[model samples]
Target: MIVRPRMHWLRMLFVWRGSVVPRILPRLGFFLALACLAVATGPHPFNLREGPLGLLGVALAIFLGFRNSTAYDRFWEARKLWGSLMIVSRSFMRQALTHPSPALSLEERREVTDLLRALAVSLNHQLRGTSVPLDALDSGVRERVVAAEHRPARVVLGLAEWVARLRHQGRLGEVLVTSFDDNLDRLSEVLGGCERIAGTPIPYVYSVMLHRTVYLYILLLPFALTGSLGWSTPLVSVFVAYTFIALDTVTAELEDPFGTEPNDLPLDAMTRAIERSVMDLAGEPLPPPLLPDKDFVLT
Candidate 1:
């Protein structure tokens, strides 16, 4: 999330806001002291063979590479799923706007448009754990809508019920209701998918085991390399620790895509865009889009 130039050495060192060093430094320091003592107090310590250290380095490289790749795959998958949800949400809004309902009066059509806007806003608020603005609804409708636990889905189902009632009253034809139902189903699918991602996470035990493995590997690395690398052990340890720890950090942050972390997908901006589009469909003056920050952060 914190973008920096490729050649910025200072930023690169501190890019993850010191997250890497804290996890890496303690073990690294201990190893450095141990390596130094082993070299200074003993003869031929620096003449150690490189075969075991080389093999360990190779193994660490492979493990870090695989871990980082798998974590990146999960992160990208989450982004793709949310992107699809946005597209489907927009498609449902478009359908609601253009789908013909011949028997509705202009006022009734306007009410339907309003309902669509409300649905978008409510869903946005619901997903983000914000309050729904019920003052915009009629008193009886407002009370009923507010009483529901899942306000967004309630509003959506309420719209479907309205459509069904209209059909029963001969004000909406079967074909139009069916089309509307299809859009509703799409919306439901989108909601369900988002919920699935938000609710489920990579298991805690797996994460804990991976984290412990990475750390233990890093901790033992210097022991294997100390005699061979000597004074260069600290520098080598830092580099090696950086790779393993950074990979672990990446996975930890990315595993939960809906979190408020800077690295997470821009869900707030996404919801606002959906709200603006739905309101535009209602013929209302659109609210401004949420702008990216100077540092490229999105709310």
Candidate 2:
């Protein structure tokens, strides 16, 4: 989501907009203060055996690494699902345009195209638990779909009904209907995938355990290092804390990629892209594509 010109070495370190540094800064400062206090207060060796602390740091690093990997998997899977939506919509256009069907009138073709666009928009809204944008659909179809419990599912059902009507009218043969139905089914699967991601979360215990361990390790690190590092402990402690805390924050954000955070998936841009692609394939005048804002964030 953070889109900008490549930065030089110094600028990259201080870049704040998209990084998790801001969120974790307060914690880092607190640890730095603890480090200074430990050194100024005669640095009580904390009697804290360095051996145990070193071992714990190693174990904690492994755990956080695994946690990040799992969260990234979820984020990547979500992105692929949205990509599938776009692919299926484009495929629908190809088959619908080529199908020989008098029952599939021009108006109905446009209606079905809008339905596909609305399905994309509806899924975006649904995952965020926001109201369906009736504006994304035609008045009549919107009225019916908005009344349904699942807006996206309703739109897809309408599409299937349109296909069924075509087949019944002898405009579409079995082969054409089957092809259209396959795309429709895939749309359902994509919607279900998004719902699964939104409804189910990484286990609460895993997060709790990591959260506790991270802060505990950060807070105790200064005491362990102050004996030898002396006044320099604050600088080194803050740097180390920054990496661990920032990584944790990144994982937390990636765990829910549907969010509006800068790092989250650009659902707004994606849905609009679907609309433009659908419009272009249908021979309609194209709308302007969505662009990143001044901050270089898309959503």
Candidate 3:
């Protein structure tokens, strides 16, 4: 995600790297050429009226607004799920470390903490459809988790088993174990929610339909306006095309918030945060927090 400090209003106009303007520039240029051609050919060759096109623009704006809203809802919901994951992980670790009758051995504490760390890394990879590195896992379950079909789910199960073992060893009472179980369930929900977003996307047909309509509108716009605006058709048409095409491109990126795009959620930074938080709770050296790049983007 782009995480830059606020810029001056004038500087904002020229900013390029993280904005969608760069992505739509080629399309805007194409529209500009078409608009120039329309001007050369004289007015309304196809008898397309500005009135209908104006109404179409309004309708398109409404649809684009709706799609953008829906896509942002998915993006925000994903961020919240990750936030919940962080909270539940810390609570689970605090309970495991402080609630038992006798303090857990340092080795046992490391084992459980590593599982939580592994779970976070695995989930990050799973969402992006990338491989989980074996080195990112705990030694005890590294091979098993790497070999599993769903790495995050397997790590979640490992957590439950560890809690059950503690209960059997008389380290935790029924009530305390139940509390642990509840947090584990929250972890599982976080995993499931991420999977849902990654597996299912905004309906392909709806997106394609809107995409086609947007281009079609932009293509016909110059012809409609040339008769009225004449020499200024290219400027107006290209500006209108920029607005529609840019919005469409942005919504497409937000629809899959787990991607490595400039505007997508910063999964790498978030996973690192999970690691730092878990290590701090385990009384181990914490890794440094991730920072955005010079371009103000966090992957």
Number of the predicted model whose lDDT against the real structure is largest: 3
> What's the true lDDT of residue 172 in model 2?
88
Estimate, for each residue in 129-158, the C-alpha lDDT of model 2 and write its tens digit. 787766756787888778888889998898
User: Candidate 1, residue 148: CA error in Å?
Assistant: 2.2
- How does each model score on TM-score? 0.75, 0.96, 0.98
Error of 3 at 231 (Å): 1.2
lDDT per residue, candidate 3, 1-299, as tens digits? 99999999999999998789888888888889999998998854468889999999999999999999999999999999999989998998899899887889988898888888888889999899898875855678797688899899999999899999889989899999899999999999999999899899999998999999999999999999988899999999998998899899999999999999999999999999988998898899887899999889999
User: Candidate 1 — what's its lDDT?
Assistant: 0.64
Number of the candidate with higher TM-score, 1 or 3? 3
In terms of TM-score, which candidate is strongest?
A: 3
The worst-scoring run of ten residues by lDDT in candidate 1 lies at: 13-22
C-alpha RMSD for every candidate? 4.5, 1.4, 1.0
Q: What C-alpha lDDT does candidate 3 achieve relative to the native structure? A: 0.91
TM-score of candidate 3 on Cα atoms, chains taken together: 0.98
Give the distance in Å from residue 151's predicted Cα in candidate 3 to where it truly belongs: 0.8
* lDDT, candidates in the order shown: 0.64, 0.86, 0.91
Question: What are the per-residue Cα lDDT tens digits for candidate 1 across 1-299?
Answer: 43334647776555543254555567657656655565465444345455765675687667657656665666677566656555655665565556545544556545555565566566656655778875754555566567888776776787787677777777656777887788778667756765666567766676777777767666555555666666676677667666767677766766666665566666667766766766576666676887767655675
| Per-prediction tally of clashes | 0, 0, 0
Candidate 3, 252: how far from true, in Å? 0.4
lDDT of 3 at 91: 93
